[model samples]
Target: MTLRNIKSVQKTLGLLLTVFSSTMLTPIVIALIYQESTSLVFLASFLITGLFGLVLWLPAKKADTEIRLHEGFIIVASFWVVLALFGALPFFLLPELGLSVTNAVFESTSGLTTTGATILTGLDELPRSLLFYRQ
Candidate 1:
């Protein structure tokens, strides 16, 4: 509840965000090897997510504190939400999928949460990199 603890959570989330952004790179590599044309989408997603992470991290990183349990829960939830949004970027950007932002969010959330539910159809026709990320 203290300002320091909150700062710790922010710092942790920021670091986590940066780390999470790196996950996008794998799909980028996949796109490169497979020539899926979605490489740029993954790259853009990586840069945007990385920048967002730094924006959240750099300001609060100087706090130099440990995260408390309550703050840990908050951080976990915040990270999941932010991660889902970031995860949906490629789906939203890809023209072939024809996914709205809302549908993209639903897909990303479902994948990340392992809910096995999605609004997407024709997965067999989707790009491999996208499918790999969802899987």
Candidate 2:
């Protein structure tokens, strides 16, 4: 959509993403609580998501006040895709687990979409850091 069309929703989403970034620290906080190496990973996720969302928001926000249903679906779908990719960063890069990138994205998508499919079998004894993220 043109920048002239969706300014209000854009600003709202921008603010929301910024707030969401703060929650990213939760993983690191939990990791620190359990003495895991999640602090850096969480910090990275926080900054990346925050900056990406922040930049997507432009001053053109005041132009658009309401969302059409079709537009709503597109926005939600695209946002989930973005979140899935970035949210998986910790899983894919952590030296402790070092899971493949594809696998990480799959897990993230499944959890986010609530699809019930999982490669995270045998989670009974998963590390506290990983389990914390799950919860």
Candidate 3:
């Protein structure tokens, strides 16, 4: 693949990441409504993810938009991996949740992929924000 194609992928991934970062707002809102302490965590996650996305996009903004077939696949894969990591941020940030990195990643991946598998127990006892995020 040419450098141009790589840049295209980078630009696309950046934009996608920024969009994905905004999804953090849903959980933030849930936290607000439920008066859960996790609001700060979710808001922090949103900012961090969004800024990282903006950093990626800003440098690649001048790159051409056209993407090759391979670049498309690469972008898709990258989206899943990056998004899963960011999606795990809230769980990782929550000290009381007691989630290890592996469990957090698995939980986020499962939620993102809709696998319906979770390591969490006592779902009913968890805060609304966490429940909403997992949903």
| lDDT tens per residue, model 3, 19-120 | 989888998888998889999999998999999999889889999998778888999999999999988999888887899988899999999989899998
Write the residue-wise lDDT of candidate 1 on 41-91 in tens digits. Answer: 889988998998999899998986676678878988888888899889888
Which portions of model 3 show Cα errors greater than 4 Å?
A: none
Give candidate 1's error at residue 15 in angstroms.
0.6
Clashes of 3: 0
Candidate 2 structure lDDT: 0.71
lDDT of each: 0.88, 0.71, 0.90
The alpha-carbon lDDT assigned to residue 83 of candidate 3 equals 92
Q: Which residue pairs show backbone clashes in model 1?
A: none
Clashes of 1: 0
List all candidate RMSDs to the true structure. Answer: 1.3, 2.7, 1.0
Tell me the deviation in Å of residue 77 in model 3. 1.1
How many Å off is the CA of 133 in candidate 1? Answer: 0.8
Q: What is residue 60's positional error in candidate 3, in angstroms?
A: 0.5
> What are the models' TM-scores?
0.92, 0.77, 0.96
